[model samples]
Target: MPKPSSISEKPHRSNTSEESCAQRPHQIVIVGGGIAGLEIASNLPKRTGRTSIAVTLIDREPAYVWKPMLHTIAAGTSDVSQQETSYVAQARNRRFVFEPGELKGIDRQGRKVYLSPTEIAGRRVLPERAIDYDTLILAIGSAANDFGTPGVREHCLMIDSRSQAMNFNREVMARILETVTARNTLNIAVVGGGATGVELAAELIQLADVSAYYGAAGLRDQINVTLIESGPNLLGAFPDRVAIAARGRLEELGVTVLTGARVVAAEADCFRLADGRQVSAELKVWAAGVKGADACAKFEGLELTRNNQIVVTPTLQTTVDSRIFAVGDCSSLPVGDAGKPLPPAAQVAHQQASHLIRHLPRWLRGKELPTFTFRDFGSIVSLGGYGAYGSLGQFGLFTGGFLRGRVAQLGHILLYRSYQSQLHGFWRGGLIWLADMINSRVRPRIRIPD
Candidate 1:
């Protein structure tokens, strides 16, 4: 790995005819190719005048997956291999440079970022590179927070990414088959009563049904799913009625929704609860909490919150430097009503990306940047094939039940589609949607053997 160059010595501006032509187009480097990062890249204005801007998107993964759909993958309902979008191809079509590299560190003083070298199949591919930028956006997203519990990092699987979720799905299916063949009981424990954990628990029930359909006899009867949470109630962020209804729905599916149960230690095949209860399982999933990625904390000279989220003002600019902007799970922007940092969710990230797309060009041209105000579009958590539950309206006065689940699911699907529309025009998005529908009809509902 080569050392990164100092930002001070790096060329900040060029003095060619192009440089003198209008305001030199600023170089915008965006980290992370997730929903937020990709949206920002796709919505960037094309270079029309002397002040053109270049956008480079960086991510460690080769493709992008709609993260909210990870639960579906874990439940064997969706195949990640077919659903993933190649970032390289999308970047080319969207007119941005895509760099597949893990972000190592950032030098705000020099306005440059150090990217780790990328390797594939034990062969070195892309060497370490330093990207200089006039404006930087950090949308690296967040990972599952384990809360430093024992054996969590080693034993439990987190469905935070496509590969991880797919691997978990394979492991789960294999375990189901093994238990059935041996006539042994199958227990799957999910830690975190939050939306992801609840949805995954529900999906597992549906997956059991699929397993039975595939000739796995007595699979549904033998399978047991447990959802653990430290809070007194599930979906703590939502209305009490919604949480209570969700618990009942989960229990109806034979999933054990254990609230106020804090997992203190995770073993290879079981987790010990704070109440000294031992719950053994064939598989364990940790989806309890989330914090910013490890790389975000390593960013030097940036003001971050206690959770390592970049501290940003109302304008979404980092407190340490105005030239750098942060969004998504990696940022902690002040919220309006709550007087706290905005919650990290897809909706907030989407809103922030849309705002940046509209105002970043103005900021580059020396115009004042507009303050980003987040709209509280309430959350909807899918309850597998059964239904969905969540609240809507300005103050969440509009409570929804099972039917709202379908609507919530559709809304979630549209969120990703909206991102697709930004990347590919509406016509292209329509074409992609049609192709997906056709492929779904022709292909097997579940993935074939790897």
Candidate 2:
């Protein structure tokens, strides 16, 4: 078996004599082991008696971390390792092949995907390689869209991935620790009114408290968190009441809520707003928006939306190629009369993954594929330990009522737990959850990197 971080360029060949070249298994390659990709890979059948199938999952990272919890990871209040699911272990248990590499390019006509060499410390770990596939599924997900803002690319930190989150955590920890001697305010300005920005603001306040508990006493008082949103309010995706509650909750926690504040540019020490006012801060985070990853632009003739997301049909197949499918935040699937695409969210990805899991076998057997219909179960936002709020949909509520406080918090947590259960099976998933609960009791929740 290959190591967790290793990738083999050679084609997977069967050792049995009965499996001849004429009867080669169908090759299914999934790129990006994110919420959708990993879920589909874990649930898809390993093989069918009449028609054999081979599954290979490729990801840039060796382990998968719930993307929704990235705010906590960036705040240094969560143990990252405890939450990550190793792709190698998952692949081994689920009967699929795992490869670690970044998708650099794609060849639609040749049915090949190009991967960049994996490197660590400026040294080569694995050479660049290509993988063949009879059918391809792209779930590469979204990245922080800077919207061509000046200095944003250079001055702001984005928590789009695990590495980016860790980098921000390190800087935050260092800056907070320095406050002990400087006796100065540790100012942080977060751009965006969405869940990412709101959650991050709340998590940073909690982080300040945790830091004080560890050693940096009075850090909470010395920290100033400002959440700037161009929109009229935060959590715009939810109902007005929910947004009002979220804004009120955040303001109560000492977070400066700035609505209708459009940031025109980012500088080393401050953000220049549209109204000529500047918000000073030592750390700036841009979680204002997300777009399909940059790599999607180089997908070799695949049709893409204005935001660089691959265009897919209702069946989740690429517009130009039936054999290639796209899902999650990376695919642009139009809905309703406006033809607006679905927002990039974990629930959207989860539903799409579930759709493919149930229908991919039919596709493999040369049957018709069903159109994917996304069911929005509503939105939930966690305000650290302060509170949580949600506008529950019919699926979430019996008679349709809003969720608040601990109920909403539990719902937010269960969202992640459900995905883990889907990927690791209920028995092991329950055990994993139990272990985490036990560990939380004995271990420190705050993570300080050495």
Against the true structure, what is each candidate's TM-score?
0.91, 0.93
Each prediction's number of clashing residue pairs: 3, 0
Off by over 4 Å in 1: 1-24, 47-50, 395-405
**Residue 138 lDDT, candidate 1, scale 0-100:** 94
Whose lDDT is greatest here? 2
Instruction: Report lDDT (Cα) of residue 114, candidate 1.
Output: 94
In order, what lDDT does every prediction score?
0.80, 0.87
The TM-score between candidate 1 and the true structure equals 0.91
Q: Could you give candidate 1's per-residue lDDT for residues 1-450 as a string of tens digits? A: 112122233244455533553465567899988778988887685622444788899998888878888888887877787678898888888888998899988876567899989999989899999997777899999888988898999999998877788899899878876887898898899999888888899888888777666777678889999999999999877778778888999999999888889899999879899999989886899998889888887888888777878888888878867667899999997765766778788888988988888876666655677678776657777886788776663544443433366786786667667767776789998788788889889886665445
1-450 per-residue lDDT for model 2 (tens digits): 111111112224444522553478778899999999999899885424466788899999889889999899999878888988999999999999999999989877567899999998899999999998877999999998888999999899999988888889899888877887899998999999999999999999998887777788888899999999999878888888889999998998899999999999999999999999999999999999879999898887789887889888888888877778899999999988898898899999999999888877766666777788888788899998999999766474463568899999999989988988999999999999999999899888789657
Candidate 1 weakest ten by summed lDDT? 1-10
